[model samples]
Target: MTLSKKARSISALEIGLPIFAGKRFLDKDLNRCFGDLEASGTLIEEIRAQELAPLLKGTDILIDLHSTIKPSVPFVCVPKFDHPAAEIIPFFNTQHIITGDGLLTQDGKPIYADTFVNAHGGFGITVESGYENNSMLVELIRDSVISALKHLGVLQGKLECGLSRAVIEKTPYPLEECTIWDAYWNVIAGENFSWTKPWGNFDSMPAGTHFATSDSTKLVAEENSIILFPKDGANIIPGSEVCIIAKKQE
Candidate 1:
């Protein structure tokens, strides 16, 4: 009796949208189309991650919802640190968390959609939920979809939200796991890239700070960093990942 059911809210911009790019996806990045599902690789997010990877194979859990290309704050991502969605993410109220992240591609495996629902064993859960004109990014994405449906018990009782209880009386902010070490790729950004400042995701950044340059080369932040997923001028894709610099996992 592994309870709690009913999921499905998907919106890769309402089905892999890319009508002239604002940077998110067109033929890719439907969270990296589950390893490019090749039904002739018929784009449109590789046939929507090949019909949503057979409806997440035998699903058990999968939260995934994101929004950040600049502004930041809310966070959550899991692909490791013993992911069972990292044991229900401390019941999420978001204070930031990303753990054991690896393959941002050295020739594959960024297969996100919560990494293909954690490669079928389920328990995925992404949730960046910030940025996109943050005005409390819509009540913190409706309180991270009601705390990932009340700690995955699949929500219940008295609802009718619109936020107000100061998001369940604030407090959050102490999760911090972070992790990844350094990322900045856009593989020589085709002879140009930019961003010397105007950071975002977790921000901090200290040791050497310089931040970005690319083809002219110069990316700094050698240590004492935090930034995550920056994507400066967006036309990216030269091996992708334009920013990542986590730290605090200790």
Candidate 2:
């Protein structure tokens, strides 16, 4: 099933409260407007850095649970160093572990929760519990947390094991950098911008094939490339990612 349908299935979080409340959780970056702080630029960042950063600064271990857009097997991301985060990988049901030298993209963007928390002297790992809105997503989070708590000695119980003792190393899929040329809000009806084919994470397409287009302008594949994060709809904004053309890691 698609991620949107799965997310919509959870009526409590997706529809129920937001019906009367108006604003939804994903409507804005709540971190930026945490309180009545009407500041801008450096001052706003500085306030959050000093005040909010301290709350997680002293935390011994932090697990940031998140969801993805694709149907993914739950996985954990740990820093490459011989840290405590890597030691607890076998306790849960997840069979994938991504260990990075530094949790930053080639463009220097921090891609994992461990990136922020590790800077503040806390052992942190990011656990992606499959697609956001999946029925099993919460169960994955609960299982991971419970297993971790037991492992950390915070809770006493026989750990309920789910998966076997092997984990897929690093990332199952590698992403390549795709430059954003432009974003087109308008496209030809029933023939607007979209992937040339039905795609999964890391599904490859060959060169000279058109991946997406708005009007007559097409983003042709530059190489034998993989499609990443194919959007469900054609609502495009300026600077939004159209596609990341990548090849399999040889």
Candidate 3:
């Protein structure tokens, strides 16, 4: 989600003119542009070392908000399975929780904002809260942030985590899925790419089924796996991710 929506909402609530304007926080895409602090001599570190590293480090707890490419239900993504922040996953509006396996990016760098925060000794959780223009998303985000603050004692209020609702712990990728993504993932031009099925987020694909294709190269599932973040093939970049193969977690 963009900060401009929240900024506008806050300003509108305070004043009646709706005169508040929202601006992009960073000029560049901070996720792909920033380098992992653990690695040495990467382009991200070379360029953003002095600028971006300080903003991520030394935070007590971090909650990052992201928008999904496809329309999706809200979900929580924990950087690692063992972090202290895992306990708060059930507090959000979603039932799904995805945990990372500490896998490095294809460039041998960590690409996630929550990963950088957690790596630097802070408890961090990433929340993928549907689409950016979702009508109810702004309210959901504000309430979730308030809930987190209360849970951490930063705000003095009643907790609003969806305690009465059940939560599902998503499993990490199976070995076969990881191997396929590492080896067969193609950075194709997404001018005409689209999923064969109208697959929702985290929907399972059977073995030997086509996922998506562009021109002559088609991506098919090698085994039973679920898909994550299947992007709508619109005016997207060539290197943008289409989707990830995963296993359904109980």
Candidate 4:
């Protein structure tokens, strides 16, 4: 299969740059990075139609690169049963599915392959490489890109094996049933709002234990389940509740 004419000449797509406004990088400076990297001058939508959409139209596979604040773990992103590419997605180490709804954005709409396919008419997958400054994670990112290319037959090589595969499945945890709570931004003296124990995505919080609180208000778990992405740090936003509580899938 032939890559879009532009993709053949242009190598990779790079987003989240221009550390400072009103500045441009020289070709040599950009060359310091791998592949044909270019600045996405505007929001992705602005250029998607004029540039990327065409390149992705006839394309069978796409690999989106992204980084997370917590770069210690690598994860693969797949749409919610909306695209054909999901069939070929390789399971990553992490079992969590980074749905568009879970992501932080000004637009409340979720970002999934369905949206991309509707606009570009192709299959694509997004991969979160890890934290921005971690050099070690960069190597992992490179390996993931290579593996994806090989899977698509864009590159030639013996594919590295995965430890195991984690299929994407969803078990809904209602807000009321999961003992929903909000993470406070500030703490005051004599206030009771505090996390008694650290919590994270897919972790279990015991029933009746103080999970979090707001201004002397106590929040306790009503049931035990996998904490699908906790509101730790700025990773989760205000008003968002625990979307899922992990129970044995029947």
Q: Among these predicted structures, which one has the highest TM-score? A: 3
Clashing pairs in 4: 71-131, 201-229, 202-227, 226-246
Query: What does candidate 4's lDDT look like per residue over 1-250, in tens digits?
Result: 4456443432565432455242222222111121112444343333333354444455555666655433235555454436644543453333344443333222332233323543355665666665556756555556555654554456564544562332222232232232322211111112223455676544566666566665567755565534433334432333333222333222
Model 4 accuracy (lDDT, Cα): 0.42
For residues 99-190, write the lDDT of model 1, one tens digit per residue.
55442444545467666667667677677777766766666666656665555456654466554754442223444443333333222243
Residue 150's lDDT in candidate 4 = 53
Off by over 4 Å in 3: 1-28, 36-50, 102-104, 157-200, 214-217, 233-235
| lDDT of each residue in 106-126, candidate 3, tens digit only | 454545556676777766677
Q: What is candidate 2's TM-score against the reference? A: 0.51
lDDT tens readout by residue for model 2, 69-102? 6666666556443565445555545655554332
Off by over 4 Å in 4: 1-11, 20-61, 91-108, 112-121, 130-134, 156-198, 206-224, 228-250
Error at 148, model 3, angstroms = 1.8
RMSD of each: 15.7, 11.9, 10.1, 11.6
Arrange candidates by TM-score, highest first: which order? 3, 2, 4, 1
**How does each model score on TM-score?**
0.31, 0.51, 0.63, 0.46
